[model samples]
Target: MQTSQQIVGQFRRKRLFIAAMVAVLVLVLTLSFRFFEEKSRIEQQSRDFANHTIARFDRMFSPLDVSANNTQALVGLRCGEVRFPLIENLASLQTVRAILLVDHGNIYCSSIYGERAISFSEAYPELAISSQRMLLTTDNYLLKGSPVLMLWTPKTLDNHSGLIQVINIELMSNYLLEPTLPWVERAVFNVGGKSLEYGNPLIEEALPSADEVSYEESSLRYPFSITLFGPPPARLALMTLPSQLPLALLLSMLTSYIVWLATANRMSMAWQISYGLTAKEFMVYCQPIINASSGNCDGIELLLRWHNARQGWIPPDVFIPLAERQNLIAPLTRFVITEMVAHLPVMPRCKSFHVAINVAASHFRDRAILDDLQTLWWPANPVPQLVVELTERDALPVVDQRVISHLHKVGVQLAIDDFGTGHSSLSYLKTLQPDVLKIDKMFTAAIGTDAINATVTDMVISLAQRLNISLVAEGVETEEQANYLRERGVDRLQGYFYARPMPLGDFPAWMDRHLAHIAA
Candidate 1:
């Protein structure tokens, strides 16, 4: 018996072989379908061309039948008297070689041989009968060694006199079919078992056998048919394979890439995060947190801004949670802190100036986060007070107790962000004993309109007062909200009414303009 590892290895090899075979089969089927589709398209185009050519021939020749009828009427009135003008009119037509007036099996007048009587039955025995209406013939009779079509109409003038118009075959071939002759290798036009061919002389002499020929036939309006022959299907497929194979492979690759991109899910986001970090696409924005009574700039909250190369300025609400889920929040948080430390010297010089950073709940579970902060903080003397704002989106794990203790020991302040939004707000408040409580924007937006939200805000204020904890009202947009929060003894305020978040580079200019406006 085989060992367990050997058996497992053998199974894996079999599975891999089967998967490879399946992939090859799929590729073969895809290429086969692509080849057949191209072949079908070519066949359809050929059919349309043949049909169009036949229709054009019909339209060109339909008028000749009507001309024959009119000439028959003229023949009935004095056949010998109307002969001169009749022959002149027929000779002027480009396709008409000659017109002859035949009466009782005898030609009395002709366009080429004028007023010369000849035996019509001996010269052309087939057209001797006055009953024969239309005939396409190749025999050399009146034109002498040229193919022509004879259009004869009979009338009862001096015992069955008839008008015969002889049409030149070469003229018809040149005008009607010459332009499109090169489209096919060989083409044969057949009318009443008589055939005229137009194509390459070499191809016509050595025509392919029936088994080796790919031919298409189209019927004309006047008892005629056009047969076109080209290279066999296998030969055509082989000739086109070189050009079409690469296109098929390229299309298959594109289809596979699109499917992979769509189904990659978290892997795609991982790639975006990796590329964004490597490219330094992330930036920091600072929103001013003001003292409610003093109206002085107390501190600023640091917010993450991602400027994707393709999609600009991804909102924190989208990317932050994604980072947390991917276990990449630690690296992202490290990037923010590192950027803040690097720009610390250029920041506005104020004794009480502080910068607060938002932290994911997952970061609390990792002790490495504290190590990273200590590495940056220990080097700078008189560093601005650092506040770590924790949100309630994810619960604080019990394992983070040691990390939280280490942070507090190092003079890092902790604040509960978006208060009253989470499920266990009161429990967290009692257990964590946080330094600041930031009222969520949802509650502040509902202060005037929503009764339940207003009461909740009032209750939060009363509780904060009793606990002696600092309270900050967020999203205070209007004077009414600002005044309401101020009256309730909210310690600090942050919102669009104060100032929207600006890049760190632009903050100093904004601060100067703001302070100047307030002073003025």
Candidate 2:
């Protein structure tokens, strides 16, 4: 069987393992929440940027669309009368470079140069077909190779007569399509099927990779959209992970430590006593009860002593009372009975020799003590007589007389140990009619020193003698005390004066030596 210390060590290791697992679980959960939170923040940021840029593009094109529609009404009129109004319209809108009027499949008037005759269908064939259209195209004829945004508002449904407005789109691209670093590395502005990026020429295919794009937004009022592209939101969230690690580790460690501290009391001394029982660390000891007059050992009181593998030599004063409080004393008592039965060979095999074991008050409930004796002790059928000792500290309940009678019928003697120390002395005498009354060591030690206790001691001896009860004076340390007890007709004397409590295995050799000393 494993010792108590080994079991305790296993418990501590298990606790630490659980604590560490909890710490690791806490750390992982915290980081997961943080990563999702950061990803959400970056996604929102990208979305806002895309929307704001699309709004700027809508604002830029709205005024030009109104200007071209107004000028379309003057398309078939006299050029001399309406040409100056076209120049005034172009000057009013700062983004508009120029405006032109097309009349019956020909450009009839211009705001910048005067009158011209450019074919509407041949020069810009795509615009001639649509009634209202926005296009991103390069002005190769006038400002060669420079990108411009063109709006066509036709005067009639014939696809020939209309007004064309031109915007210097390259200058506007710098402000509306500027990239936001770290979040948005580049922004693209797409019109019709053509796309333009800030500080770069327009491209035929301006599609951003799905993995690299942060957010994309299309204008509701125009044929255009803005796309912001950079590293994925997931990657940005991960970049922030290093900064979040230290606090997460600290919190997880604090939680684990609190858990460890909270469980300390559960694994305290009471738990150790229980473990000690399982590990069989408790040893059975016996203090010899000498015959006061003959100086011959008549009986032995079985005592319990603990020697923990880790914490050695625990005192009875500490663990005994604790065991009773923790409801473990009964099991401990059962262990003592079992050990005594196993080591019965080491004891004197005579009916006159008694083996006394202390029983706690709780053990009397439901005739538990009687049951233990009958089940564990009576089966052994050892030669020595059995004595059940009740101490003054015990407060036994109203026991059924049948149980006591059964114990007496089985040749079990009842003794009241540590007599005259409690208020129940007279009550026990009236109820139990005990065979032996062991005087408390306090009164025995006070034999010659204190008169008041000495008188009480005398009374106890006299009372037992009158009742024909056997008297056992404990704590007899000197010849004076022994002589006094023997002179007073005390039936037995037990204390340091004879022999101290020793292990059950050593009793046989000690008895031989004691008998030899008595004979000498």
Residue-level lDDT of model 2, residues 1-520, one tens digit each, is 4444555576687668878888898899888889999999998988999888878878888888887777777889877888899888888998878787888999888787778888877777778864437778897667888888877877777877888888888888887888887888888877776888877875555656766864678999977778778888899999999999998899899988887877665555677888898898999999999998788999999999999776777788667777877788899999999999998887889999999999877777789888888789989879999998887687666755556667788778989988998778998898887889999999999988999999999999999999999998989999999998899899999999999999998899999999999999
lDDT of 1 by residue, 140-207 (tens): 55645455667665665433467788876556654544433223465555554455566321112234
Worst ten-residue run, lDDT, model 1? 199-208
* TM-score to true structure, per model: 0.55, 0.57
TM-score of 2: 0.57
Model 2 regions more than 4 Å off: 1-270, 309-311
Screening candidate 1 with a backbone cut-off below 3 angstroms (N, C-alpha, C), the clashing residue pairs are none
Worst 10 residues of 2 by lDDT: 1-10
RMSD of 1: 17.7
